[model samples]
Target chain A: MISPSQVEVDRDKGNFHYDTDYSFDAGIGLSEDVIRYISEVKEEDPWVLDFRLKALKTFEKKPMPTHWATEDLKNINFDVIRYYLAKGQKPSRTWDEVPDDVKNTFERLGIPEQERKFLAGVEAQFDSEAAYSRMNEELEKEGVIFVGSTEGLKEHPEIFRKWFGKVIPTSDNKFSALNSAVFSGGSFIYIPPGVKLAQPLQAYFRINAENFGQFERTLIIADEGSEVMYMEGCTAPKFETSTLHSAVVELVALKGAKIQYVTVQNWSNNVFNLVTKRALAEEEAEVRWIDCNIGSRLTMKYPGVILRGRKARGEVVSIALANDGQHQDTGAKMVHAADETSSNVVSKSISIGEGRSSYRGLVQMPGHLKGCKNNTECDALLINNNSQTDTYPAITVQGDANSVQHEASVSKVSAEQIFYMQQRGLGEAEAMSLCVNGFVNDLIREFPMEYSVELKRLIDLEMEGSVG
Target chain B: MNSLKIENLQASIEDKAILHGLSLEIPKGEVHAIMGPNGSGKSTLAKVLSGHPSYKVDGGSATLDEENILGLEPDEISRLGLFLAFQYPMEVPGVTIANFIRAARNARLPEGEKVKAVDFYKELYEHMDDLGMDRKFTARSLNDGFSGGEKKRCEILQMSMLSPKYCILDETDSGLDIDALRVVSEGVNRMRNPDRGILVITHYQRLLEYIVPDYVHVMSEGKIVRTGGKELALELEERGYDWIKQEAVA
Candidate 1:
């Protein structure tokens, strides 16, 4: 019989690390000077420096949100974390020109291979700055601007300035404030009106340094009647101490436009991943957030959407898996402000070993809105008796004509189920994997073909240690 | 020599003795029927032989073609060409019938080898049609919401797909209707070849009338008390099991 490791193992795929000598470092602390040093190193405008300085103050003024969050938040030491580190100020336009160490890291992660196969553009981020960024020439000629946020702010100020932090403002939460203060090396995309791209753009974020924080800022603006799909991936090597990854993503879908954003993050267990993502949809527009979170010590993210114009739609399809010593606290939020708006939220989670998963959601419709509808379904699967799952959904709907529905369920992979599959000649691990794949079968279909296969493989690796 | 041999098989569940030193054997090219009353340990024998986790075999040995299978895992037992049609099939939600059966078929193949999808579907459709099951049932979850007859037909479908050397039908005719029983019996009849040993456990004589076993064994309390031909089933059906119990006691 073939062991699980022989079938393209993933547990060791992201565990390797490389050493690099960074040319730029913003010291190890959070202060006004450090923020100024970052803004000056990037050679930003004076107004941008002011923005960073103000965000630093906000980050310090806000307290850690530990009331409802895990007590592990006290373990994060902001004083010792290196705020920013990069090899250079500018990203290499070609893969050949990138530094050998950074290039080799991305190569091992299969970034170049994926770019060659299906992606229209590829951005590889190392620590504090983008190392390699490229896009299709054909797309550039069609007025699609796909570049790093540094380049976007420097080149296309008129378009980037209008919606940089509009969707998720820095003052919205403590993590958002922290990300706004030290954000770097995230994708900035703008699809012009009436241009519908058939291919997706991808970005890969890698955290290479120890005792560091990687804060990325992403923004996508789909103009009127335009459509685009953007996907991002993240990974980090295991560290003895803790690391931090805080990102803020904002999406704006204009009238009659569509935008779909997908993210699959696999961080090491020593990393704390706290992110804020949201979208603003206009009349007849659609915005979808497809997110999958795996392998992290603590993750607290709730991707949301605001239906601002009449007849707008929003959706969030999420899958979160928490293994040993991990907690995945994820969900979605929807706010209906106009007439005839609709939204759907479907989330599934799996907790194995001593892992814990929680789904917290909110859906609100004011009294004046008419013909607005919302539907939410949350399901959780427990793999062991020690594993835990919880659901906390807060829904409020008013007005006689509006409608809302919510459903929640919790299931366990019973011994009988496992025995039944074993009786059919499947080994214990194979039976467990099949049962898991079956539980998330319908949701996995929503992912792209390539990612669905990888997701199944990753789950198989997670189940290897699950059988006791 | 090629047979399922049980020697003084003793078993229990939850510290309660159920099968007390019951011994039986079914050689190749023969069909055996075990008829008993409610508490006579008919189903326990099947569970014990299949190595169900709940039952503990205190003492004895069971062999499939001279290979000991008393303590092996259920999957290992199954891979050795022993198939037990469960009395109550499990409902595995969201696992489609096709994929479930394909997993079983794939497990039998050598490592790194897979069953060709086209051939698997062709054979599955043929067996499903023979059992009068709907063609669309392949996409449905494995016995998730199926009726009793449909569940029975699915069990038989799995049995036919695996094609084990030894088959044990544990009360396969309990919930089947008249028409379903006929179709199921026909399906079992088609699988009755000289290389296989079939054991049917039932509380009534109705199912045996269709399959027509070669040997009829009357079980009382846990042991087989009387061994006879197919005519013995008709005699018991005409009379009752009380005389058999009295005879065993006497």
Candidate 2:
């Protein structure tokens, strides 16, 4: 088995190959012609083509965000972005069948090894398409439908048509509309009723093509009495010019079912990672979102949950690390729409150097709901004097019997704490890292074993040279 | 050479004076105990000697074997061979005890040198065993979720690993029961050596019974009011602080 520490070292080195051979025309922006061209290139069905066209119209009608915390959206220059770039490769079923360059990329990222050791299945996506996808025989025999979204649309139209865009409609936001219009190369998982997958299904997304936007649409449906854990890992080669990764993910947990989704997003510093992910929990169903955001130039993601059935539960455990020139504006949103529902949201962020990390969350208990409860706690640690952090949590409790609580705190690595560690012989930087690691250790423990180790190493790497 | 000395120490918190004109010296190969009542500035003296930022030394000085330590940072003071086992050890959430001590040991090494993982773990396990700490505690966060006794043992475990020339255990026996106090004292006793000096701070004489000190000093209102042999602790425990207060007033 590959040690998680080694993965951490490799992630810090970030020596992934940037495939310069692939190039696409960037002047082509979002348009009906572009949508039709994408459909033609994918050989998509006529109905899928019509859906893309309708989404393109919605994308055009929606206005840019006027109430976001930052103003970088005004400079997006959508016309300069290449909405879809296939990189001239079709999805392969076997690792050996994949091109050497693409396979080597996944190998360096430790995806193939992870698949063999612990993952029940694996899907590796490069740029705009899944270059390789596979499932273990045991899972395949059990009738689990795990494939790339595009393939799912083609093979299982019945399941695809019924739930696609239902959780997050095209008009949800400007970025969601854009993703719906040009989405490609994400996972589609359907766990059969009453069947629990023993191991997590994993996917790795990489952006090796420059000036390209990766809009992968992922949808997971856990049927009644079923349980499954899905993990998504993403990275991109460092590019001088900014790349955009705007994807939308939707999850549905049927009555008495449970779904746990884990995401470890470590993009290069030159990418803007703006994603919208949400889930719908039915009667007595449970949904959990465990997200770790470690790297990006600017990231704004809030994984949300809507409790639609009585006695359903929703939870979100998130950790964000923002270092030099990065802004991680992330949190979770929970809406209690049914009676006797409960939700918990715990968010921890660490800001180093001049980085800024903010938590913006919402919890609403409508008047129709009775005996609902929601609790949110957002804590931030600033490593240095120049770093900054903020928390903005909004909780609206309308029902008389509902309860809501919100707590937030921001603290710096105390000089005395560093001195205490240093007196034991640690240098200033090592002491600061230890204190910061201890500050977020509780949240890190919530992650899978491998991810928790990798997250610590990532923090250590970002902490190097952080103190004078 | 392994001795700690404080000369006419004057310190304050937030510019308000606390420890004023206090002088004490502890020599190597001996254990000294400081007994005091509430608000006697016992904790502040420990913090100032370790260079806690909350306290500013407006005047006076302290030294660990000829090295002026008042100007150095708390960590620097520790690295210079003094260790303050905090009365209330901060609960460091994500850092395991092994890693925390390892970082401390690594800091002591010259730049570019690294500690071998195998040797580090071996040493940690041995010290943990000596302190009667479970091997699993090495993997747990430092002092996080630890009982009062377990926290004190953790401090002793750290003191053992660092092997400081002068160890100042601030209120080491606070909140400990009879069994826990004995276990913690045994851990400290195991580390007793001719090359080390220990200063144990406590309110009750029960701790001194197990980790008996060579000398005992009664501190009242930031100054050492009286100094005597080990029997001083026994006398105070029997008669209480009123006798010490009467002596100080006289």
Candidate 3:
């Protein structure tokens, strides 16, 4: 467990790193040999190794989606990026047993303190593997299984093999294929039926190696009548050359079950964060995604939900902030396949300096589905003249009984408003921050208390030097 | 020495001169009123003193208690104990009045020392009641979609809460009915103490009846052309501004 005084955790202060001396390092570039090396090192089952080999072929066959994505995607040279780097294969069950360097990094991130305060379980992943993973004794007694992906695959093959690639397959997209080929260190959680955890399970992903690509695969399953919440945070030190982070997260909610997934990623401007997250909800089940993206050079993520059973509900609440030299392309997607299914999406974005932000949403209700309802609202705030924002919503509703509503708006922080607040004793930056917070006030209230406070502080730090 | 003294204040906006070498003084323990016609630069004076970015001060020396405030930022001037109640308060959507005022108050406190929440709310409610405002207004957005009279009362609410050394009310009486005028005037009158100075800028003499001024100055074109006592307001209301314009030309 780490103390509060040992950490100076400012995600924007990107100068922190620990010396790396990994015993296993699969040099640079992507090849069958590299994938084989990773599978061989993990001692994975033959089927899992076969899956990786096939996914590597899929990754090689697909091209970068530069037609819709930013041209910056072309700048990434896959041949030079280190595919895998890890200290060891297995994660320690206790913090004291972890290596000193890895433990120090997580300590500086305040993960142990957070675990002690509110988290029921914690997994701190340093690079390609988790350094420490633990859950509460009471939760373990309740048959809740929480561990890193490596352990989950080897130890709980019966459950893991059932829903491993059922929700989001490797063929879902190019990034998903890439992730499936060389993925490591993410959480695999299973909440037993009728067991409702009071505290959330947390995972912290830290990218410590330079010129490295971190691909973490996460899967969460909530059984019938169970409820669970999972949160993940990602950060990396600034590197001279750009780094890559492509992760795949899939969720499953059984009948009468509820699952909430929250993510707050504040990567350095030198990292490209592209992730795929989706959830499948059965009869009377609910799934909610709360996402906040603060820092990244280019981030393209659209968390989605597939409503598969009657009376299933889905929701997505997202807030993205793009500062100078950053592009945050994010939104939500909902696919209704059952009668009486419903979904809602609310997204807010702030663009400062020369940053650009866009919202691309997709909502579909086929002709067979009846009594389906979908509502989406996206609002954008531009802080400077050079800031840019865009929205592209694709909605297809066929059945007359199905309905969809969408609203979007773009607003700027006016000079007069800033002056008026300044006359009331607020500094220029403070005034801007207040207006921005107010713009996203209604949506921010939905965030938890701890996250809302941290979000406000992060916005204040980004608002500095925003005004002349 | 303890006054808001302006000497040869020259100002303009967008290359168009609005105030041509205007000057006035409002010392402590006094309230002054400036009556002017349309485009007479009365509003410009309020903006110039508060460091509005649109208005440029070509040449002037405005001081508060011997500290020059011409080149200071708007927030700096505000922290120096000067408050401006805008005629049209900009609407800050989603920012509740309570939080907005609390931020202003927090800015005045020393570092790391915060206002007690209970005591602050108590004082705020009392002030809101004095202005005849509903207690629920504290939770509403700041001046967003508020009625004309409600906006005026909110301005007065902020003035009383800030309790600055000098207060400038720009057209505070405009767009208000008689009943609202009285409630707003009472809110201002409560802030009238020996340690503060108030400057009221209005186009008509209607507001002067409720909040009587110690001195009255008539502004024509860009500068003050007549100075008198409170009786001058009655005279102007009877004769209108035509006579004052004629007198200033002569």
Candidate 4:
């Protein structure tokens, strides 16, 4: 077995932090000054700075959430968070050329090795900056553009500006407003027309600084007749003082194109992971969101899809595991805006110890969108008596020809099942792990093979100390 | 010395009586078939012996090799040489058959002892082959998306791998077709040993044709009404359970 220290070093370097200052004294509130400071730091064009300023105003005007899953929003202090922190380094094109500390972090996280072995491209982000970004030469030659969002802005402004914040606008939600105001260091991917990338492009995000908010914005566009898969892995160090990670991601699948976005968020219990992700599917296009949330103090994420064209399809497969002092509130939203649109949302969550998990989803079809169909299934597993899980799914079908089905169930690991496993010679913990694994195995299998293995290992790690 | 003895065993579910004054014994090297109609406490007996928490044993004692098994936890009972193949095997979604069985096998070893993966898979494949299970089933979740026959075969496969001292199979043939029944029975037959006792519980005697129990006990209203050799199963099958109910009343 690989030593935990080795695995820690390999997995921790890029994203996991150690012993950092916890003072939230940086009173960089959501203001014009902070937005200007960020734009100045990035040395953005005048028009980009104007965009940031407008977004900052939007952030200030938006009120804290007053709707569903808003109880935890009270703890977020917008004034105390450092909007942006740059280590003063340009993004490197090669892993070896990256700075030592950042390179060591990615090395520890095994980012470079994973990129070499499995990924067609990799972008390593440290705090508020992209330390290293690379694309397979063949992919670049094939007109596939994968780069950090900042670089994409500078290099391919036309493509970047067209889809940026389009799917999820700044005023869409309070978190999206915050992300648009001070977003930094996320991937911008564009698959050219009719180009198909077999291998996934991955991005690794690491939160090393303390009392800071890492807000990154990502936009991916799969043009006509193209297909691509993008995977993201994120983690943060355990800290007593709360750290914030807010991100906004937007995806566009043009006619006859397909795109799948996969995210595995494994933040420490001290980090607050609040993200907004959505995609738009055009005629005959398909979009899929494969998301897994394993660790966090409080996480609120719902990846959604808007079916904007006839015959469009969308799907979201997600698994959320909350252990101890954690709360994972996640689900998906599907809006059928055109005729014959179809969507499926399957989400499973496991709550152990005193942790709580909730599934909140929505399926909406307008009266004019005939032949639209949606299916939503949400299941939760409680590992212990103290754990809690809840599911709230809302479906509205205004069209007579539309069909929607929703099913949800919450159950505990029965003592009989545990005893049966033990009788087969499994210990209590092993049996519980098997049950939890079985509970979410269907969704995990939907991930890429390598990611599926990592997910199982992560689940096993969380299963530790789950049973007493 | 060779039996799983239940001396006046009494059990209940939700404070209601289920198995009352039930006493039976199956000795090693023998297969005892317990036949009963629905709600006759046949399934309850299997669960109670395996320490299902829903059932509370209020009185009497059950012993494996003279060790008081009543006070022990279910897992402890299982580890102490008893195995219960559930009639409705729970679908453990993400857990593969190979890993599930391995974890069970690992539990039997001393602390810090590990099972060699290669050897474990080799053994698993061999057992799966004997059960006529496709090797792909090892990669699939335990009983998830499986047919009734597949689930029963999986239970038998687990039994074969765990190799318990005494095995209690609950309604193992309830949902199987003729072909699946034969395959599952063959898996159980191969696991029979001189040192291992088997208790088969079924509503019908059709399973006995393949498993060939050494003894057959007709249970009515939570107690063993009559005990006979293998011929009793054939007789029960020929006359049906209504006759047994009439005899119990008489």
Find the candidate with the highest DockQ and give its number.
Answer: 3
DockQ, ranked from best to worst: 3, 1, 4, 2
Question: Which candidate model has the greater DockQ, 3 or 4?
Answer: 3
- Model 3 bad stretches (over 4 Å): A1-14
Among all windows of ten consecutive residues in candidate 1 chain A, which has the lowest summed lDDT? A1-10
Best of the two (2, 3) by TM-score? 3
- Candidate 3 C-alpha lDDT tens digits along A378-429: 9999888888999999999996999999999999888889999999998887
* Residue A21 lDDT, candidate 2, scale 0-100: 54
Q: Candidate 3, A294: how far from true, in Å?
A: 0.6
Q: Which sections of candidate 1 miss by over 4 Å?
A: A1-10
iRMS values for every prediction: 3.4, 7.1, 7.1, 5.4
Task: Give candidate 3's error at residue A419 in angstroms.
Answer: 0.8
DockQ: which is higher, 2 or 4?
Answer: 4
Model 4: CA > 4 A from native: A1-28, B1-27, B31-73, B86-157, B169-192, B199-250
Tens-place lDDT per residue, model 2, A366-436, is 88778999989999988767778988888888958998888898887766566567657676767777888
The 10 consecutive residues of candidate 4 chain B with the worst lDDT sum are B46-55
- Backbone clash pairs for candidate 1 read none
lDDT of each residue in A319-403, candidate 4, tens digit only: 9988878899999999999999999999999987788999999899989778999999999998877788988888888958999
Please state the Cα-based DockQ of model 4 relative to the true two-chain complex. Answer: 0.40
lDDT: the better of candidates 2 and 3: 3
